[model samples]
Target: MTRAPAPGHGGMASTRTHSAEKKRNSVTKAPTRLWGGRFEGGPSDALARLSVSVQFDWRLAPYDLMGSRAHARVLNRAGLLTDDELERMIGALDDLEAACRSGEFRPAVADEDVHTALERGLLERLGALGGKLRAGRSRNDQVATDLRLYLRDHARQIVSRLVELETALIAQAEHNLGVAAPGMTHLQHAQPVLFSHQLLAHVQPLTRDIDRLRDWDKRAAISPLGSGALAGSSLPLDPQATAAELGFDAAAPNSMDAVADRDFVAEFLFAAALIGVHLSRLGEEVCLWASQEFRWIEMDDTYATGSSIMPQKKNPDVAELARGKAGRLIGHLVGLLTTLKGLPLTYNRDLQEDKEGAFDAVETLLLVLPAMSGLIATMRVNTERLETSAPDGFALATDLAELLVRRGVAFRDAHEVVGHLVVWCQVNDKDFDDLTDDELAKVSPHLTPDVREVLNVQGALASRKAYGGTAPDRVREQIAALRAQVNDHASWAADSEA
Candidate 1:
């Protein structure tokens, strides 16, 4: 074999030489495979087609390059490369990163995955010296490291977007404070509540979702970079150093677990799925409220869609999509869990199945969150309609029962009394407000004229003044508390990006 040129003398000159050679032999020269030095021949065409991952995983190139930079530092500390070689290697990686970002460099047809493609880029720049960077690490650990970094970065982004949605909710609540609406149990009006309280209910789940992402980051912060192919490297590599350089809390403690563990991905999928479920519920409400039967809201023209055929239609498409995509997100979570269930310890080819679901889920949420936020921020609430219909379905019957309880009637007796009054009103075609004192006296002895005190929607709303209740003051307190939470989450997300 012809001897390759040495490193220092041909650094930049080698790049130009390799670039020209790459063009001249673009079709004819066989791409280098990361493994199979001992094999007599290349993989079969079918095997190559089935094994390829460069398409979806190429998005991981930035994180992969980040790992490579930190790995280079560890290799230099291990004395695997001279200081000058490390410097040259870091420079080459930076150049390659710029190329990747600008789309000048990309995976070719034969490149199996991101690692192979990036390695090719490095080799093109530094010639044989580029091959030295792979020492003391395997694709197993490298990929695990890349994924953790990718998720950590995205978790912060998701939190930031979540806060934006929360902020929209807070604004709507503040604007509509003290507006009373029918609160339901089992979709039947049970009581009257501040409309702000209903809007704030959606914020609670999103806050927990943000908390879950923050909590998930704690477990995901440990790096797996130095675990070489499910076994520790024989070389004197410093994994803790690599972990710190890459912003991981520490190195993974077990070699086999480092390469094999995908619990982080599963947990992320769960968080994402739960977010979808919560949004689905919110979407269901939007659909109902915008319907002619409810007429509780009117969606903005920008957010609502016009029907192709029906001139009168202004469809809640954003809310419908939110409800529809929830199932897709749920399927991604279940699919990943099923994929992970029977996986044996250490890395397997099945682990390759992890990235696409995660990538798609993240992309889905990133797309959905901003749209949902805009939908909420821009839509108009029909406060008059909500307030007028607040007590239409005997919504204050419970308040009437409780009012009798305060007047020394046993709750059971009061409940029976209110039941009779509701039946009497339905039969007589008269609401409680329309009942005369003589009519009230005939229904029950406890149905004195003063019973009308609890019959109106505003009185029913004001009666529930306990903490976390639907009273106006309580709902204001709840809104303040949520605003504080949104601020704290916003700060945490900002710090994480920093």
Candidate 2:
């Protein structure tokens, strides 16, 4: 229930009050406002309500404190603070962090944002010396620095989780090796493919997503700490030193761009949104495969829920949520892009809209990636159903065409022949298996009984022996490649954290 003291209170205590109660009251009195030099009055209640961001941005407190610590070192290097003052400042910040961790510190309603609250906490801890911490920094640059640091840490976390999810997929593919399934085009059964091939298809895009996070991290690694407001700092501050302290790769090249650039956030949102879309596609399959019509997979009890009204009804709530949340993730990306689009230059209060969406996305994927991985890891795959379904719906039609091509029939002629046969089968309520050699030969002289060799599921699978194809060996190669890629990222994420 403890709140940060109001602006300017900065925890300054008056020692001259005679009565103990009066002395306590005087100690807790609001101090002079940090930016009240020209203002005759404080912000209106509505303005305060509209402006305060600490409610959500408090998650950035640790990053803010980290930035402050880095800034403190830079300040000492600039001779803005003595070594003694720097020592006291670090100790006080450490105490403030402990208080924040223990729930002993929280933002006051009067505080505008986390920056304001932490400044107040620091002032309370070190009195006047705490005031020096704000000398060469503006909240604008400090917030930019904090957001980058926060996202860098979180991006690594996201990478690690992605690796877990990828590993789960690799395991699933390895477990279900050579199990055949119907692959689709436009949601209609188009071909017979190994279940492992389908699983590795999903793995390919996720690998690119991890690559995107790694690429974004490189750009986001630059420090914006010494970029005062929208211009470079007047003081002789060493941005490289600050960057090194905060684990950034370098200082930002342009101070204005440094303060105003939210491309990093937009890129992160885009990455998260794409991740959502990928997971939704995976979720849709789970929902489909778990249904009575498909019955290709049995939902694990741990990852599925039963309906309240129906005794026999098990609902795919987890998959459904993952599918639904994709829209939310897209909305977050669009909303943030819109916020950034119209801003003219430099820092704007509108930038306050940035943190919540980014934070929600990070937290959301943290849950979703693990849940999806667990769902895949534990679910029972009905390989019999998958194999049985693989050759149905004339799924081997393409293989029939290819077999004709091998028989020296022109591809166009083969395609038309197969197309006609497909319509004929549909109208006659018969499948390729029911076709007579005479009937097939009537359509094309080249359609001999030997063509029947390629009309079944195994032949359909074996014909695709090219690299990246659905043949068992190719799929095994894909899984191995995917595992190596996942392992590389896993190593990078672990090393980066170290």
Candidate 3:
């Protein structure tokens, strides 16, 4: 791939303006060549199109301008720029930002990337003073710094969306207290579990995703501004000053690694991929539960969609989209990692591939999260159907086995007894409740009238009151714990911005 012109070389116009009138006219003059005294002529049309990244990267204009402001301050501190020059440069940058925000400033066909476009804008505003701002900076370190700041801000936004989805889960769990459903393993009914317990299972992984974002932020906080074009800058620059001004924890220790490292990007994509997987799991369940065969829940009209031809059809489009989008999220992660896998120990054109994937992953999640939270919040569980089906498919067979174990039978013997009872019920088309005491005795010598006590679904549910169990009490306790954790994370996210 064709690489755009790197920064911090001999690009800007020479600072030799003797006449004040000529300098004033320079501000409105056509932009000077970004690469001066090098090539004989312009690049090929194909090369320019292939190298331009300002179209997609224009979103980084604000962040690039922010880093430039910090860089200007550092340059002034190092006495490389006079106070008046620094003041004019900052004022021009402020004007550029306002124009960018108002859509009045944008990349032209000649602007190769965000850095170049912003440079052109600054020159248009302040002439030679704008040229001075490029002294101690390079697009290599500038792009790196801008990306970190952008990801830091957007990661917090993604976390807040996750918290909203988590809060919706906890609320649903609390509201569905005491409701029972058939828990499945391998897509077959296994046991009776409180509906709340299943909801909390989804919340557990998302809480870890939130923690991953926090951990990723810590590593991404180091600034790379002074690592000019893969080596330390020649100027008497204060990297720490710029780091502090940009809200970074510190400067990166190595110039080569500082410009080349993309671990933070990969880590963020991994977090997003996992979240997509989690949401896909929820989507699959919602799709199953909302179907005619299950009828365990109903999607609200706001989230569900009608078939184009079939007027009676109400499809769970949001859940299906969530499930489908998971593959896209995984694709983004894999593509980015593949791009980073073979690069050398410095900045390269291939690194430009990183931003689009990460951007897609972030944008995908930001859109999916609120839709998911709304889907869960507006969904109505069919409590009567859930409660009625909780005991079907021999779901209480485990309870029968445990009851026999309590009556002094060995566990192996109890398991055998329940296995035989299940086979009998399956062949005869009769449930466990259909059997009388004599019929039960005929199946096992350990049978007794009190065995009926554990045969009911509620008895089976209450019997497992162990911590983290699906019992109503245990599920309620889990709901409370999750709520506290979510609230704590929300507070931490707020303080991160502060």
Candidate 4:
């Protein structure tokens, strides 16, 4: 049996040696680093191999291909590449992309990074003409440019998935309409609320996460391609031309800031962390709602797992995993922040550390967001259990006071009367509804047959007909408004593309 090759070194040729071989065979017989003129000799084989990023960055093929085309046109416009050379490079880039997409482009293990692999591919495809495309650009600028494009694309996909998750939550809320549940504060039941209201609370934060991604794209719109190698290029290049071709609103103003800025990366992490927080909030509720004591929700067998030791146990593995993954999302943010913090201006080896953090965050959220949506969509709400738990906390005791006010009892006095009656029921092992008229009258001779009016939980919930209340009428109105907001958010995302 053949042994697998070790990481960092595949067989005898180091990652750097492979890079040099690629450069050696490349259109430039000199095998030049885009910025190697300042150096006396090529990087050490071990150092080159150690610094390689082609493995993960191959994911940037599309962005690299697109950006190369954009840069080629920009160079042609600047009178540097000539129109014929530009056409050749563009055609070669397209063919190279097709090769990558079709799995025919064999990546070199020593190919320093994605920028290097891309240049190597272009050279192999276009012969000597590919050399002209890199006349003024460095991998420093190229990598940064590719990353921005990749993130912009990834953010759109994740936010769309997030919107889908929000839609599922909204649908669940609608399906469980009028299902009464106890709303809690400090883990103790505080009031009666529609179960939909609680689910909608989780939806609102995730929706904000989608909005955050859409907003951050605006900041990422500037292209960094022309900020070659930290200092502005001396080639008299037109940054705006490339920026326009690439769909950037403008060229980044400062060269050093352009290569050094992983702020866009950090912003994506910021957005991902917020999504993590929202998922954690939803996960916590899922865990609680699925508990034996609560028993307000049931996880589908497909989404849940049975305990190994306990034969009858059905656990919410999906929510538990989501809650667990939320920690990883936070760790990605902190790791990226710490990695980028205190780094010097312009490009550094440390910026290479940026990819894993963001890539992990995006990968985790992409999986968890969609899985959570499916879990919520398929799970059943135990409406009877929700209603049964609703009346335990004397959730309608406040309604009794509201009833007194309608009867012309001063609110302050009515509040005292309800408080006394609640204590009376508690001391006697009775629910607020279990108290008889004689018992209610003992607390208040003013309490009439109308005291029976406050005993019904449905009547109590219905009386709360104020705007945004959990009353059936109010909930329906809220549903309409929430649906409208979802449509408005969708429209805003569409307008951004316009």
Candidate 5:
């Protein structure tokens, strides 16, 4: 009998034959199942489609590998693996990690989830020895630990981006320190405020967001690695050693709680959603400022997009997307909360619904924060327009009222006098600067010429000397304090990354 030619041995004929043989092997191979010893047959195609999560959870591959390494060490300490076996296992895992990072190893079509795909890779590398690593842990505890590691790493990234945005706001405030703008109450000018004051207002909410993330980290640092299935393993595995190896503060106190708790994910979603809301508010202002009607800011050509139909248009699409994505971020939070609301779990299939939304939320904020920071940093402020419009719509009327109060006039009476004076000025088509001595006396005897001192925009802005006020001096102090806070937050984020 003649033996078949070896693959790639004969020119084109051998290459074609090799391709056919590889295709046949792929078609005939069955997926490795992690569990199913009790089942008589495979799951239906419909069940398989619904159950597979390797598409999204595959992003957790790195974290999953880290968990496996830690588990291998713990198993070695328990004498489940010999010293030679442990070293071999570590070498194989390191090779697998390189393949994963280089995109050479990936999930096969039948892989159920990240864990199953990674296990298959391990088996391919080490054969029967790979099975030993799964001795003390279940997918239940494994997935829980992987997600915490994933979120903990990404949370630092989110904080660093937040600090970048805050630093941009601080830079804008410092650059426009002396500029004045009309501050609005009901979208109508209410007072003359230093432009720096408005920019710094956004920084305050972001500081709180950073604090929330830092606080959330404290609760998310516990490991769940040895919490097998639900009730923990009966083996001699050391969970504390695994937790320390994985960078967790401690192993979970209770195995059931360890696998079932998704509160960390929910809390993270809340923090992300609130950051979205704050960005939405800032984006709304950017949209208004960039419009022709406001013209308080001019969008930089690099950051702003042009309309395809309107050549003259420099649209604030960056800010508009920031506004639009806030809704998407909020929906992710609510969707995850709804998924988690009814599950009575030690570990239920419903819990698998958690990863996609949390992953998307983190990715969305990471995208939005940097774009917004560049927009704020590069946009040009129209200081002349801001100062010119600062005292429009009788914005200084409150200053006049307060002046009368300081002269021993009752506040109620002073308010009444200022109200009438505004009416007279409106009907006569004149502002406070246009008012004659005879006209002031007729409007209100208390409208003495001394009131003129506070009627102008400069005087209106300067008179607010109280701490936290919009006075230029107060704004300078606020900027200094905020800079120190941003520096501290930057240091915290750096430590987290380290």
Candidate 6:
């Protein structure tokens, strides 16, 4: 029964502390390497167990392999590697990467992160030749480079999915252009609006989200591979050549800045959080519109579910999941921000906590955006329900004031008169159009029965003839603009990877 050390035991302790422990789980190594040369003994097994990130960071192997291959090519061309040695090193790296991707390679428990795991794999695969690949880099720069590569690729994917979601939104809007619904303020009817106009409002913000992700990609394009530790490597390596080969737009100019700038990570998650808010807003509407009380839209069977106990229940599980997903996306952003708030220096083990958050945000957006898009595209808008509800409340009251303003009445006097009329209608258990002509004229003798002409929901929506209004023409104009924006994005998305 050997007891655990108090707080700071400093020997090469046993590795049995971790429950799922395996021999290959820690960053196993040659003890006398450059990083460990100053130390007499190794990290205690307890420390190793706590410090290892191989369990999750092994996801980075492919990126690690790519950076290592690029570095090896640069070193050999700079006359560092012998011709035969370079060939053996490059061949082994390529093979190791292929094995990792093909699932034949397994990272051992002794490996700490993907960088260490890959190096271990390389050393075993090519013996002495593999040792030469680490000549001009550190895990600091290497891990940062790998993360940048991973982010660029993932951001591009998220942007494309956002575009797809925008397209679905536009499709739904166009399909329901003539549809009218009660636009609400604080969840109560405020005005009659084209259903398509409501849909367009949702589309534009998500479109901005796509642009935000694209903007993030441009910033994330700098390469971090030459910034070894917190200083530039002394090796006469061409950072540009490696950047170009690896598809980075430029080499990171400063070593410390390269490793310290986790801003991109936080930026991405923040953008994801904004997009998640958009999805949540969209989901809230879907959940509401699909409700038996509103019935503005019906969820198609594929995107809805049933209640086991209630035989007639058709639950909107998809939208509910979108609502739930938004919380995760937002949590990811907050989690990463908290992780980065007070960190010091070029790299710390604290930085390793960064991966789980980013991985979750990316995965959530990729999944949530598409599912939400499909839900929108397949939904059925019950136009009659919307129209009936749109007119039931005095939703056209604003249209009445606009009509009065158009009729040579002072706008201030018209607002007063309109408010009185609404209160009258509400008290009498009637609607705006249900008012008698004499009642309106009592408030303002200049008013006539013709005022009721502006009181219907369609009249209310159609009367908003300003640019970007809920008028049918404005809705069509917006649909055209949305379509154009989506087409441009589609083309850019198609050519992005190329």
Which lDDT tens digits does candidate 1 get at residues 213-237?
9999999999999999999899999
TM-score of 3: 0.93
| Count of backbone collisions within predicted model 4 | 1
lDDT of 5 by residue, 1-498 (tens): 011111111111222355555753573387878997889998999999999988888888888888898899989999999999999999999888887776556676778888888888898889999999889899999999989988888888899999999999999999998999999988889988988999999999999999999899889999999999999999999999999888889999999999999999999999999999999999999999999999999988989999889999999998999999999889988998998888886889999988988988988999999999999999999999999999888889999999999999999999999999899999999988899988999988898777799988888888999989998899999999989988998898787677
Better of 2 and 4 by TM-score: 2
Candidate that would win on TM-score? 1
Check candidate 2 and list the clashing pairs: 8-31, 9-31
Count clashing residue pairs per candidate. Answer: 0, 2, 0, 1, 0, 13
Runs with alpha carbons beyond 4 Å of true place in candidate 5: 1-28
> Which segments of model 6 are wrong by more than 4 Å?
1-34
Off by over 4 Å in 3: 1-33
Could you give candidate 3's per-residue lDDT for residues 140-235 as a string of tens digits? 899998888878877888888999999988888899989989999998999999998888999999999999898889999999999998888889
Reference-based lDDT, residue 305, model 5: 94
Q: How well does each candidate superpose onto the true structure, as a TM-score?
A: 0.95, 0.93, 0.93, 0.88, 0.94, 0.91
The window of 10 residues in a row where model 2 has the poorest summed lDDT is 1-10
Q: Give the whole-model CA lDDT for all candidates, comma-separated.
A: 0.88, 0.85, 0.85, 0.79, 0.88, 0.79
Name the weakest run of 10 consecutive residues (lDDT summed) in model 6. 1-10
Model 2 per-residue lDDT tens digits across residues 281-306 = 99999999899999998988999999
Model 4 residue 431 lDDT score: 87
Per-residue alpha-carbon lDDT of candidate 6 for residues 1-498, written as tens digits (9 for 90 to 100): 011111111112334335324333433535213356677787899987897776666666767777887898899888889788888888888788776765445555555666766777787778777778887788888888877877777676777888888988888888888888889899998888888899999998977887787788788888988888888878889888998888889999988989888998899889988988888888988999998889888888998899989989998887888888888888888887888889888788788888878877877888887888889889999988887787666777778888888988988998888888888777888766567878888767756888878877777777788988889998899889888888877676666655
| Global CA lDDT computed for model 1 | 0.88
